[model samples]
Target: MRLGLHALGIGTGAEPAVIRAVAGAAERSGFATLWAGEHVVMVDESDSPYPYSDDGTIAVPADADWIDPMIGLAFAASATSRIGLATGVLLLPEHNPVIVAKQAGSLDKLSGGRFSIGIGIGWSREEFEALGIPFERRAARTADYVAAMRTIWRDDIASYTGEFTTFASIRVHPKPQQRRIPVLCGGNSDAALRRVAQWGDGWYGFNLRDVDDVAAKVATLRGLCEQVGRDPAELRLSVALREPRAPEAGRLAELGIDELVLVASPPQDPVAAAQWVTDLATDWQ
Candidate 1:
Protein backbone atom coordinates (compact mmCIF):
# COMPACT_ATOMS: atom_id res chain seq x y z
CA MET A 1 0.00 0.00 0.00
CA ARG A 2 1.18 3.57 -0.70
CA LEU A 3 1.64 5.98 2.20
CA GLY A 4 0.86 9.70 2.05
CA LEU A 5 1.65 12.25 4.72
CA HIS A 6 -0.91 14.95 5.36
CA ALA A 7 0.23 18.34 6.80
CA LEU A 8 3.04 19.59 4.59
CA GLY A 9 1.54 23.04 4.05
CA ILE A 10 -0.26 23.94 7.23
CA GLY A 11 0.40 24.93 10.84
CA THR A 12 4.05 25.16 12.02
CA GLY A 13 5.71 23.62 8.93
CA ALA A 14 3.82 25.96 6.61
CA GLU A 15 6.88 28.25 6.44
CA PRO A 16 9.34 28.01 3.56
CA ALA A 17 12.26 26.46 5.46
CA VAL A 18 10.15 23.86 7.22
CA ILE A 19 8.06 23.08 4.15
CA ARG A 20 11.15 22.42 2.03
CA ALA A 21 12.82 20.38 4.75
CA VAL A 22 9.78 18.25 5.53
CA ALA A 23 8.86 17.76 1.87
CA GLY A 24 12.39 16.69 1.04
CA ALA A 25 12.46 14.41 4.05
CA ALA A 26 9.14 12.84 3.09
CA GLU A 27 10.24 12.25 -0.50
CA ARG A 28 13.55 10.75 0.57
CA SER A 29 11.67 8.56 3.03
CA GLY A 30 9.71 7.02 0.13
CA PHE A 31 6.37 8.67 0.69
CA ALA A 32 4.09 8.43 -2.36
CA THR A 33 2.34 11.80 -1.86
CA LEU A 34 2.16 14.96 0.24
CA TRP A 35 -1.37 16.35 0.78
CA ALA A 36 -2.31 19.93 1.67
CA GLY A 37 -5.86 20.82 2.73
CA GLU A 38 -7.44 24.28 2.48
CA HIS A 39 -9.96 26.59 4.06
CA VAL A 40 -9.68 30.11 2.65
CA VAL A 41 -11.25 31.68 5.72
CA MET A 42 -12.87 30.51 8.95
CA VAL A 43 -15.57 32.15 10.93
CA ASP A 44 -14.93 32.56 14.65
CA GLU A 45 -18.49 31.66 15.51
CA SER A 46 -20.81 29.85 13.15
CA ASP A 47 -23.64 27.36 13.15
CA SER A 48 -21.91 25.09 10.65
CA PRO A 49 -21.36 21.58 11.96
CA TYR A 50 -18.02 19.95 11.29
CA PRO A 51 -18.92 16.71 9.51
CA TYR A 52 -15.76 14.79 10.28
CA SER A 53 -16.00 15.05 14.02
CA ASP A 54 -18.39 13.44 16.50
CA ASP A 55 -18.76 16.82 18.11
CA GLY A 56 -20.18 19.53 15.91
CA THR A 57 -17.05 21.68 16.17
CA ILE A 58 -13.95 21.95 14.03
CA ALA A 59 -10.55 20.86 15.34
CA VAL A 60 -8.80 23.87 13.86
CA PRO A 61 -9.05 27.02 15.89
CA ALA A 62 -10.65 29.92 14.07
CA ASP A 63 -7.35 31.82 14.35
CA ALA A 64 -5.28 29.15 12.64
CA ASP A 65 -3.21 30.29 9.66
CA TRP A 66 -4.24 28.67 6.37
CA ILE A 67 -1.88 29.09 3.43
CA ASP A 68 -3.26 28.51 -0.05
CA PRO A 69 -3.10 24.81 -1.00
CA MET A 70 -1.77 25.42 -4.54
CA ILE A 71 1.01 27.70 -3.28
CA GLY A 72 1.91 25.17 -0.63
CA LEU A 73 2.04 22.37 -3.20
CA ALA A 74 4.19 24.57 -5.42
CA PHE A 75 6.66 24.93 -2.55
CA ALA A 76 6.66 21.15 -2.08
CA ALA A 77 7.11 20.58 -5.85
CA SER A 78 10.26 22.71 -5.98
CA ALA A 79 11.74 20.60 -3.18
CA THR A 80 10.94 17.05 -4.32
CA SER A 81 11.64 14.99 -7.43
CA ARG A 82 9.30 11.99 -7.33
CA ILE A 83 6.77 12.52 -4.55
CA GLY A 84 3.21 13.38 -5.63
CA LEU A 85 1.47 16.58 -4.47
CA ALA A 86 -2.27 16.92 -3.92
CA THR A 87 -4.92 19.03 -2.29
CA GLY A 88 -6.61 16.96 0.39
CA VAL A 89 -9.88 18.73 -0.36
CA LEU A 90 -10.09 22.22 -1.77
CA LEU A 91 -13.43 24.00 -1.41
CA LEU A 92 -14.35 23.90 -5.12
CA PRO A 93 -17.41 26.10 -5.50
CA GLU A 94 -15.83 29.10 -3.82
CA HIS A 95 -13.54 30.02 -6.74
CA ASN A 96 -13.81 30.48 -10.48
CA PRO A 97 -13.26 27.27 -12.49
CA VAL A 98 -11.23 29.00 -15.24
CA ILE A 99 -8.70 30.32 -12.73
CA VAL A 100 -8.56 26.92 -11.02
CA ALA A 101 -7.85 25.21 -14.35
CA LYS A 102 -4.97 27.59 -15.03
CA GLN A 103 -3.52 27.14 -11.58
CA ALA A 104 -3.94 23.34 -11.61
CA GLY A 105 -2.52 23.06 -15.14
CA SER A 106 0.48 25.24 -14.32
CA LEU A 107 1.22 23.31 -11.14
CA ASP A 108 0.97 19.96 -12.92
CA LYS A 109 3.28 21.10 -15.73
CA LEU A 110 5.82 22.63 -13.34
CA SER A 111 5.75 19.54 -11.14
CA GLY A 112 6.24 17.23 -14.14
CA GLY A 113 2.69 15.83 -13.89
CA ARG A 114 2.79 15.03 -10.17
CA PHE A 115 -0.22 17.11 -9.13
CA SER A 116 -3.78 15.99 -8.37
CA ILE A 117 -6.75 17.91 -7.02
CA GLY A 118 -9.13 16.55 -4.38
CA ILE A 119 -12.18 18.74 -4.13
CA GLY A 120 -15.45 19.03 -2.16
CA ILE A 121 -18.54 21.14 -1.88
CA GLY A 122 -17.75 23.21 1.21
CA TRP A 123 -19.73 23.07 4.47
CA SER A 124 -19.19 26.55 5.85
CA ARG A 125 -22.06 28.78 4.91
CA GLU A 126 -20.50 31.74 6.71
CA GLU A 127 -17.28 31.28 4.80
CA PHE A 128 -19.17 31.30 1.51
CA GLU A 129 -21.05 34.42 2.60
CA ALA A 130 -17.75 36.08 3.39
CA LEU A 131 -16.47 35.21 -0.08
CA GLY A 132 -19.64 36.62 -1.65
CA ILE A 133 -20.54 33.24 -3.19
CA PRO A 134 -23.86 31.44 -2.98
CA PHE A 135 -23.89 28.34 -0.77
CA GLU A 136 -27.02 26.76 -2.26
CA ARG A 137 -26.63 24.04 -4.89
CA ARG A 138 -22.91 23.85 -4.13
CA ALA A 139 -22.73 20.21 -5.21
CA ALA A 140 -24.06 21.12 -8.64
CA ARG A 141 -21.59 23.98 -8.77
CA THR A 142 -18.73 21.64 -7.96
CA ALA A 143 -19.80 19.30 -10.76
CA ASP A 144 -19.94 22.13 -13.27
CA TYR A 145 -16.63 23.58 -12.12
CA VAL A 146 -14.84 20.25 -12.47
CA ALA A 147 -16.31 19.64 -15.92
CA ALA A 148 -15.28 23.11 -17.06
CA MET A 149 -11.75 22.69 -15.67
CA ARG A 150 -11.36 19.34 -17.46
CA THR A 151 -12.41 20.90 -20.77
CA ILE A 152 -9.86 23.68 -20.32
CA TRP A 153 -7.12 21.14 -19.66
CA ARG A 154 -8.05 18.83 -22.56
CA ASP A 155 -8.50 21.38 -25.36
CA ASP A 156 -6.02 23.79 -26.93
CA ILE A 157 -8.87 26.24 -27.36
CA ALA A 158 -11.56 25.48 -24.79
CA SER A 159 -15.28 26.17 -24.68
CA TYR A 160 -17.76 24.86 -22.09
CA THR A 161 -21.35 25.61 -21.22
CA GLY A 162 -22.33 24.63 -17.71
CA GLU A 163 -24.74 25.96 -15.09
CA PHE A 164 -22.02 27.83 -13.25
CA THR A 165 -19.45 28.22 -16.04
CA THR A 166 -19.85 29.36 -19.64
CA PHE A 167 -17.23 30.47 -22.12
CA ALA A 168 -16.67 30.80 -25.84
CA SER A 169 -13.79 29.07 -27.62
CA ILE A 170 -10.66 30.61 -26.18
CA ARG A 171 -7.04 29.63 -25.78
CA VAL A 172 -5.76 28.51 -22.40
CA HIS A 173 -2.06 27.85 -22.68
CA PRO A 174 0.40 25.54 -20.89
CA LYS A 175 -1.84 22.48 -20.73
CA PRO A 176 -1.00 19.86 -18.13
CA GLN A 177 1.88 17.45 -18.80
CA GLN A 178 -0.40 14.55 -17.84
CA ARG A 179 -3.18 13.75 -20.28
CA ARG A 180 -5.54 14.30 -17.36
CA ILE A 181 -4.79 15.49 -13.89
CA PRO A 182 -6.53 13.14 -11.47
CA VAL A 183 -9.63 14.52 -9.79
CA LEU A 184 -10.31 12.82 -6.45
CA CYS A 185 -13.75 13.57 -5.07
CA GLY A 186 -13.92 13.97 -1.27
CA GLY A 187 -16.76 13.30 1.20
CA ASN A 188 -18.68 10.44 2.84
CA SER A 189 -22.28 11.23 1.93
CA ASP A 190 -24.33 9.29 -0.65
CA ALA A 191 -24.09 12.26 -2.95
CA ALA A 192 -20.33 12.11 -2.59
CA LEU A 193 -20.34 8.42 -3.54
CA ARG A 194 -22.42 9.17 -6.65
CA ARG A 195 -20.06 12.02 -7.52
CA VAL A 196 -17.12 9.61 -7.40
CA ALA A 197 -18.85 7.10 -9.68
CA GLN A 198 -20.01 9.79 -12.10
CA TRP A 199 -17.08 12.17 -12.54
CA GLY A 200 -14.17 11.53 -10.19
CA ASP A 201 -11.01 9.69 -11.12
CA GLY A 202 -10.80 8.63 -7.47
CA TRP A 203 -12.51 8.77 -4.08
CA TYR A 204 -10.90 10.26 -0.98
CA GLY A 205 -12.63 9.34 2.27
CA PHE A 206 -11.22 11.26 5.20
CA ASN A 207 -11.35 10.88 8.99
CA LEU A 208 -12.22 7.21 8.85
CA ARG A 209 -12.24 5.55 12.28
CA ASP A 210 -10.71 2.21 11.41
CA VAL A 211 -10.30 -0.54 8.84
CA ASP A 212 -13.92 -1.59 9.24
CA ASP A 213 -15.02 1.96 8.46
CA VAL A 214 -12.89 1.94 5.33
CA ALA A 215 -14.33 -1.41 4.31
CA ALA A 216 -17.90 -0.23 4.73
CA LYS A 217 -17.26 2.91 2.71
CA VAL A 218 -15.49 0.99 0.00
CA ALA A 219 -18.42 -1.40 -0.27
CA THR A 220 -20.82 1.50 -0.51
CA LEU A 221 -18.68 3.10 -3.20
CA ARG A 222 -18.55 -0.16 -5.14
CA GLY A 223 -22.32 -0.44 -5.08
CA LEU A 224 -22.66 3.13 -6.25
CA CYS A 225 -20.17 2.50 -9.08
CA GLU A 226 -22.13 -0.56 -10.15
CA GLN A 227 -25.34 1.46 -10.24
CA VAL A 228 -23.65 3.95 -12.54
CA GLY A 229 -22.09 1.21 -14.70
CA ARG A 230 -18.58 2.18 -13.59
CA ASP A 231 -15.93 -0.34 -12.69
CA PRO A 232 -15.00 0.22 -9.06
CA ALA A 233 -11.49 -1.02 -9.80
CA GLU A 234 -10.97 1.81 -12.25
CA LEU A 235 -11.04 4.42 -9.50
CA ARG A 236 -8.31 4.97 -6.96
CA LEU A 237 -9.47 4.75 -3.33
CA SER A 238 -7.67 6.63 -0.56
CA VAL A 239 -8.48 7.07 3.09
CA ALA A 240 -7.10 9.16 5.95
CA LEU A 241 -7.09 7.43 9.31
CA ARG A 242 -8.83 9.38 12.06
CA GLU A 243 -6.50 7.93 14.65
CA PRO A 244 -3.08 6.28 14.46
CA ARG A 245 -3.62 2.59 13.82
CA ALA A 246 -0.36 1.29 12.40
CA PRO A 247 -1.28 -2.37 12.72
CA GLU A 248 -4.15 -2.03 10.27
CA ALA A 249 -1.94 -1.32 7.26
CA GLY A 250 -2.04 -4.85 5.86
CA ARG A 251 -5.77 -5.06 6.36
CA LEU A 252 -6.27 -1.75 4.58
CA ALA A 253 -4.22 -3.06 1.67
CA GLU A 254 -6.28 -6.23 1.65
CA LEU A 255 -9.38 -4.08 1.33
CA GLY A 256 -7.92 -2.39 -1.78
CA ILE A 257 -6.95 0.98 -0.37
CA ASP A 258 -4.59 2.66 -2.84
CA GLU A 259 -3.13 5.13 -0.37
CA LEU A 260 -3.30 5.52 3.40
CA VAL A 261 -2.92 9.10 4.62
CA LEU A 262 -1.99 9.92 8.19
CA VAL A 263 -3.10 13.17 9.74
CA ALA A 264 -0.09 14.93 11.28
CA SER A 265 0.22 17.67 13.81
CA PRO A 266 2.60 20.64 13.67
CA PRO A 267 5.82 19.16 14.98
CA GLN A 268 8.09 21.04 17.31
CA ASP A 269 10.98 19.34 15.51
CA PRO A 270 10.10 18.84 11.86
CA VAL A 271 13.17 16.73 11.06
CA ALA A 272 12.58 14.40 13.97
CA ALA A 273 8.92 14.15 13.04
CA ALA A 274 9.87 13.20 9.50
CA GLN A 275 12.28 10.57 10.81
CA TRP A 276 9.60 9.19 13.11
CA VAL A 277 7.18 8.95 10.21
CA THR A 278 9.86 7.24 8.13
CA ASP A 279 10.43 4.72 10.89
CA LEU A 280 6.71 4.04 11.14
CA ALA A 281 6.46 3.57 7.39
CA THR A 282 9.40 1.17 7.47
CA ASP A 283 7.73 -0.82 10.18
CA TRP A 284 4.47 -0.95 8.21
CA GLN A 285 6.24 -2.01 5.03
Candidate 2:
Protein backbone atom coordinates (compact mmCIF):
# COMPACT_ATOMS: atom_id res chain seq x y z
CA MET A 1 0.00 0.00 0.00
CA ARG A 2 1.01 3.60 -0.56
CA LEU A 3 1.66 5.75 2.53
CA GLY A 4 0.72 9.44 2.82
CA LEU A 5 1.21 12.16 5.42
CA HIS A 6 -1.53 14.55 6.53
CA ALA A 7 -1.74 17.92 8.37
CA LEU A 8 1.10 19.44 6.37
CA GLY A 9 -0.72 22.75 5.87
CA ILE A 10 -2.05 23.34 9.35
CA GLY A 11 -0.37 24.79 12.43
CA THR A 12 3.45 24.46 12.25
CA GLY A 13 3.34 22.67 8.90
CA ALA A 14 1.93 25.81 7.31
CA GLU A 15 5.38 27.37 7.27
CA PRO A 16 6.82 27.58 3.74
CA ALA A 17 10.16 26.05 4.58
CA VAL A 18 8.57 23.23 6.55
CA ILE A 19 6.08 22.44 3.77
CA ARG A 20 8.87 22.43 1.17
CA ALA A 21 11.19 20.27 3.26
CA VAL A 22 8.55 17.73 4.35
CA ALA A 23 7.14 17.47 0.85
CA GLY A 24 10.63 16.89 -0.58
CA ALA A 25 11.53 14.37 2.10
CA ALA A 26 8.26 12.51 1.62
CA GLU A 27 8.91 12.28 -2.11
CA ARG A 28 12.51 11.15 -1.62
CA SER A 29 11.51 8.63 1.04
CA GLY A 30 8.92 6.98 -1.26
CA PHE A 31 5.80 8.45 0.31
CA ALA A 32 3.11 8.67 -2.33
CA THR A 33 1.22 11.81 -1.30
CA LEU A 34 1.23 14.89 0.95
CA TRP A 35 -2.16 15.95 2.33
CA ALA A 36 -3.37 19.25 3.77
CA GLY A 37 -6.71 20.03 5.40
CA GLU A 38 -8.58 23.32 5.76
CA HIS A 39 -11.10 25.11 7.90
CA VAL A 40 -11.61 28.71 6.69
CA VAL A 41 -12.22 29.88 10.22
CA MET A 42 -12.84 28.41 13.64
CA VAL A 43 -15.20 29.78 16.22
CA ASP A 44 -13.92 30.05 19.80
CA GLU A 45 -17.11 28.48 21.05
CA SER A 46 -19.78 26.66 19.11
CA ASP A 47 -22.36 23.90 19.48
CA SER A 48 -20.80 21.98 16.57
CA PRO A 49 -19.91 18.50 17.85
CA TYR A 50 -16.47 17.39 16.68
CA PRO A 51 -17.22 14.06 15.08
CA TYR A 52 -13.67 12.67 15.15
CA SER A 53 -13.10 12.87 18.88
CA ASP A 54 -14.61 11.36 21.99
CA ASP A 55 -15.17 14.79 23.41
CA GLY A 56 -17.52 16.97 21.39
CA THR A 57 -14.82 19.59 20.88
CA ILE A 58 -12.00 19.80 18.36
CA ALA A 59 -8.42 19.68 19.64
CA VAL A 60 -7.36 22.69 17.58
CA PRO A 61 -7.43 26.09 19.28
CA ALA A 62 -9.39 28.85 17.57
CA ASP A 63 -6.17 30.79 16.96
CA ALA A 64 -4.14 27.95 15.44
CA ASP A 65 -2.24 28.84 12.27
CA TRP A 66 -4.35 27.36 9.50
CA ILE A 67 -3.24 27.82 5.90
CA ASP A 68 -5.48 27.48 2.92
CA PRO A 69 -4.94 23.92 1.63
CA MET A 70 -4.66 24.84 -2.06
CA ILE A 71 -2.20 27.65 -1.43
CA GLY A 72 -0.14 25.45 0.89
CA LEU A 73 -0.08 22.62 -1.65
CA ALA A 74 1.00 25.08 -4.33
CA PHE A 75 4.02 25.90 -2.14
CA ALA A 76 4.65 22.19 -1.63
CA ALA A 77 4.47 21.66 -5.39
CA SER A 78 7.31 24.14 -5.93
CA ALA A 79 9.43 22.04 -3.54
CA THR A 80 8.72 18.53 -4.79
CA SER A 81 8.27 17.08 -8.28
CA ARG A 82 6.94 13.59 -7.61
CA ILE A 83 4.85 13.37 -4.46
CA GLY A 84 1.10 13.77 -4.95
CA LEU A 85 -0.48 16.79 -3.26
CA ALA A 86 -4.07 16.67 -2.07
CA THR A 87 -6.56 18.28 0.25
CA GLY A 88 -7.49 15.84 3.01
CA VAL A 89 -10.91 17.42 2.65
CA LEU A 90 -11.81 20.83 1.26
CA LEU A 91 -15.17 22.04 2.60
CA LEU A 92 -16.97 22.37 -0.75
CA PRO A 93 -20.26 23.91 0.34
CA GLU A 94 -18.47 26.97 1.74
CA HIS A 95 -16.96 28.16 -1.55
CA ASN A 96 -18.15 29.24 -5.00
CA PRO A 97 -17.79 26.39 -7.50
CA VAL A 98 -16.50 28.52 -10.38
CA ILE A 99 -13.76 29.96 -8.21
CA VAL A 100 -12.79 26.53 -6.93
CA ALA A 101 -12.69 25.16 -10.47
CA LYS A 102 -10.41 27.96 -11.60
CA GLN A 103 -8.06 27.46 -8.65
CA ALA A 104 -8.04 23.68 -9.02
CA GLY A 105 -7.45 23.79 -12.75
CA SER A 106 -4.64 26.29 -12.40
CA LEU A 107 -2.97 24.26 -9.64
CA ASP A 108 -3.30 21.01 -11.56
CA LYS A 109 -1.85 22.57 -14.67
CA LEU A 110 1.11 24.01 -12.79
CA SER A 111 1.68 20.82 -10.80
CA GLY A 112 1.74 18.63 -13.94
CA GLY A 113 -1.45 16.80 -12.92
CA ARG A 114 -0.11 15.73 -9.54
CA PHE A 115 -3.08 17.12 -7.63
CA SER A 116 -6.28 15.48 -6.37
CA ILE A 117 -9.18 17.00 -4.50
CA GLY A 118 -10.74 15.44 -1.45
CA ILE A 119 -13.92 17.31 -0.65
CA GLY A 120 -16.53 17.19 2.07
CA ILE A 121 -19.89 18.67 2.95
CA GLY A 122 -18.74 20.54 6.03
CA TRP A 123 -20.04 19.55 9.46
CA SER A 124 -19.49 22.73 11.47
CA ARG A 125 -22.70 24.74 11.45
CA GLU A 126 -20.95 27.73 12.96
CA GLU A 127 -18.32 27.84 10.23
CA PHE A 128 -21.02 27.76 7.56
CA GLU A 129 -22.93 30.52 9.34
CA ALA A 130 -19.76 32.56 9.57
CA LEU A 131 -19.26 32.17 5.82
CA GLY A 132 -22.87 33.36 5.32
CA ILE A 133 -23.75 30.00 3.77
CA PRO A 134 -26.61 27.78 4.90
CA PHE A 135 -25.59 24.58 6.69
CA GLU A 136 -28.57 22.56 5.51
CA ARG A 137 -28.65 20.81 2.11
CA ARG A 138 -24.86 20.98 2.09
CA ALA A 139 -24.57 17.54 0.54
CA ALA A 140 -26.80 18.56 -2.32
CA ARG A 141 -24.79 21.71 -2.71
CA THR A 142 -21.58 19.69 -2.68
CA ALA A 143 -22.85 17.48 -5.49
CA ASP A 144 -23.98 20.46 -7.53
CA TYR A 145 -20.73 22.29 -6.94
CA VAL A 146 -18.66 19.31 -8.01
CA ALA A 147 -20.77 18.90 -11.15
CA ALA A 148 -20.31 22.53 -12.01
CA MET A 149 -16.56 22.34 -11.48
CA ARG A 150 -16.29 19.24 -13.64
CA THR A 151 -18.26 20.93 -16.35
CA ILE A 152 -15.87 23.87 -16.28
CA TRP A 153 -12.91 21.53 -16.45
CA ARG A 154 -14.28 19.33 -19.26
CA ASP A 155 -15.86 21.74 -21.70
CA ASP A 156 -14.36 24.72 -23.50
CA ILE A 157 -17.72 26.44 -23.54
CA ALA A 158 -19.08 25.05 -20.29
CA SER A 159 -22.67 25.50 -19.27
CA TYR A 160 -24.34 24.05 -16.19
CA THR A 161 -27.63 24.51 -14.39
CA GLY A 162 -27.94 23.21 -10.85
CA GLU A 163 -29.82 24.08 -7.69
CA PHE A 164 -26.94 26.12 -6.22
CA THR A 165 -25.05 27.12 -9.36
CA THR A 166 -25.68 28.29 -12.95
CA PHE A 167 -23.31 29.26 -15.74
CA ALA A 168 -23.45 29.59 -19.53
CA SER A 169 -20.89 29.46 -22.35
CA ILE A 170 -17.90 30.08 -20.14
CA ARG A 171 -14.38 28.97 -21.08
CA VAL A 172 -11.89 28.10 -18.34
CA HIS A 173 -8.27 28.07 -19.44
CA PRO A 174 -5.20 26.02 -18.44
CA LYS A 175 -7.08 22.78 -18.03
CA PRO A 176 -5.54 20.17 -15.79
CA GLN A 177 -2.84 17.91 -17.29
CA GLN A 178 -4.87 14.94 -16.23
CA ARG A 179 -8.09 14.23 -18.10
CA ARG A 180 -9.98 14.33 -14.84
CA ILE A 181 -8.85 15.51 -11.39
CA PRO A 182 -9.61 12.64 -9.07
CA VAL A 183 -12.31 13.72 -6.65
CA LEU A 184 -12.30 11.80 -3.37
CA CYS A 185 -15.41 12.35 -1.32
CA GLY A 186 -14.96 12.43 2.46
CA GLY A 187 -17.39 11.27 5.20
CA ASN A 188 -18.88 7.95 6.36
CA SER A 189 -22.61 8.64 6.29
CA ASP A 190 -24.80 6.62 3.92
CA ALA A 191 -25.24 9.85 2.01
CA ALA A 192 -21.47 10.19 1.85
CA LEU A 193 -20.96 6.61 0.72
CA ARG A 194 -23.59 7.19 -1.92
CA ARG A 195 -21.66 10.28 -3.00
CA VAL A 196 -18.59 8.10 -3.29
CA ALA A 197 -20.57 5.78 -5.52
CA GLN A 198 -22.18 8.48 -7.60
CA TRP A 199 -19.70 11.36 -7.61
CA GLY A 200 -16.24 10.36 -6.37
CA ASP A 201 -13.25 8.75 -8.00
CA GLY A 202 -12.56 7.47 -4.47
CA TRP A 203 -13.64 7.49 -0.85
CA TYR A 204 -11.45 9.15 1.75
CA GLY A 205 -12.26 8.00 5.29
CA PHE A 206 -10.75 9.97 8.15
CA ASN A 207 -10.13 9.01 11.78
CA LEU A 208 -11.55 5.56 11.23
CA ARG A 209 -11.14 3.21 14.21
CA ASP A 210 -9.48 0.14 12.72
CA VAL A 211 -9.21 -2.22 9.77
CA ASP A 212 -12.64 -3.59 10.64
CA ASP A 213 -14.18 -0.16 10.38
CA VAL A 214 -12.56 0.26 6.98
CA ALA A 215 -13.73 -3.16 5.93
CA ALA A 216 -17.32 -2.45 6.86
CA LYS A 217 -17.29 0.90 5.13
CA VAL A 218 -15.65 -0.54 2.04
CA ALA A 219 -18.35 -3.21 1.91
CA THR A 220 -21.02 -0.56 2.18
CA LEU A 221 -19.32 1.45 -0.55
CA ARG A 222 -19.16 -1.61 -2.76
CA GLY A 223 -22.88 -2.22 -2.28
CA LEU A 224 -23.60 1.39 -3.04
CA CYS A 225 -21.47 1.19 -6.16
CA GLU A 226 -23.39 -1.88 -7.29
CA GLN A 227 -26.64 -0.10 -6.65
CA VAL A 228 -25.45 2.66 -8.93
CA GLY A 229 -23.99 0.20 -11.46
CA ARG A 230 -20.45 1.38 -10.81
CA ASP A 231 -17.76 -1.23 -10.41
CA PRO A 232 -16.42 -1.24 -6.83
CA ALA A 233 -12.89 -1.99 -7.99
CA GLU A 234 -12.86 1.18 -10.05
CA LEU A 235 -12.99 3.32 -6.92
CA ARG A 236 -9.91 4.07 -4.85
CA LEU A 237 -10.09 3.76 -1.06
CA SER A 238 -7.95 5.96 1.19
CA VAL A 239 -8.07 6.12 4.97
CA ALA A 240 -6.40 8.32 7.54
CA LEU A 241 -5.60 6.33 10.68
CA ARG A 242 -5.87 8.24 13.95
CA GLU A 243 -7.12 5.70 16.49
CA PRO A 244 -4.75 3.74 18.71
CA ARG A 245 -6.04 0.49 17.26
CA ALA A 246 -5.38 1.49 13.68
CA PRO A 247 -3.65 -1.26 11.74
CA GLU A 248 -0.30 -1.23 10.04
CA ALA A 249 0.20 -0.25 6.39
CA GLY A 250 0.35 -3.85 5.14
CA ARG A 251 -2.85 -4.78 6.95
CA LEU A 252 -4.75 -1.88 5.51
CA ALA A 253 -3.58 -2.89 2.02
CA GLU A 254 -4.81 -6.42 2.72
CA LEU A 255 -8.26 -4.90 3.30
CA GLY A 256 -8.06 -3.32 -0.22
CA ILE A 257 -7.15 0.21 0.83
CA ASP A 258 -5.06 1.91 -1.86
CA GLU A 259 -3.52 4.41 0.49
CA LEU A 260 -3.02 4.84 4.26
CA VAL A 261 -2.52 8.41 5.48
CA LEU A 262 -0.77 8.79 8.82
CA VAL A 263 -2.27 11.66 10.79
CA ALA A 264 0.39 13.27 13.02
CA SER A 265 1.38 16.74 14.18
CA PRO A 266 4.17 17.84 11.87
CA PRO A 267 7.20 19.60 13.35
CA GLN A 268 7.62 23.33 12.92
CA ASP A 269 11.15 23.31 11.48
CA PRO A 270 11.98 22.23 7.93
CA VAL A 271 14.87 19.95 8.92
CA ALA A 272 12.89 18.34 11.72
CA ALA A 273 9.81 17.83 9.52
CA ALA A 274 11.97 16.33 6.75
CA GLN A 275 13.47 13.93 9.27
CA TRP A 276 9.96 13.22 10.47
CA VAL A 277 9.00 12.24 6.95
CA THR A 278 12.02 9.97 6.57
CA ASP A 279 11.38 8.33 9.94
CA LEU A 280 7.70 7.66 9.15
CA ALA A 281 8.57 6.30 5.73
CA THR A 282 11.13 4.01 7.38
CA ASP A 283 8.55 2.87 9.92
CA TRP A 284 5.98 2.33 7.18
CA GLN A 285 8.37 0.08 5.30
- Which residue runs of candidate 2 sit more than 4 Å off their true CA positions? 244-247
Instruction: Indicate the residue-level lDDT of 277 in model 1.
Output: 62
lDDT of 2 by residue, 19-127 (tens): 8888899899998888898899899998999877768788888998899999999998998888898998999999999999989998898898999999999889999
What lDDT would each prediction earn against the true structure? 0.88, 0.87
Global fold similarity of model 2 (TM-score): 0.97
lDDT of 1 by residue, 1-285 (tens): 898988766677576767877788788888889999999989889899988888878888887777899999998899888999999999999999999999999999999999999999999999999999999999999999999999999999899998888998988868999958999999988889899999999988989877888899889889998998999999988899888577888899898899998777646476766666677568657
Residue pairs clashing in model 1 are none
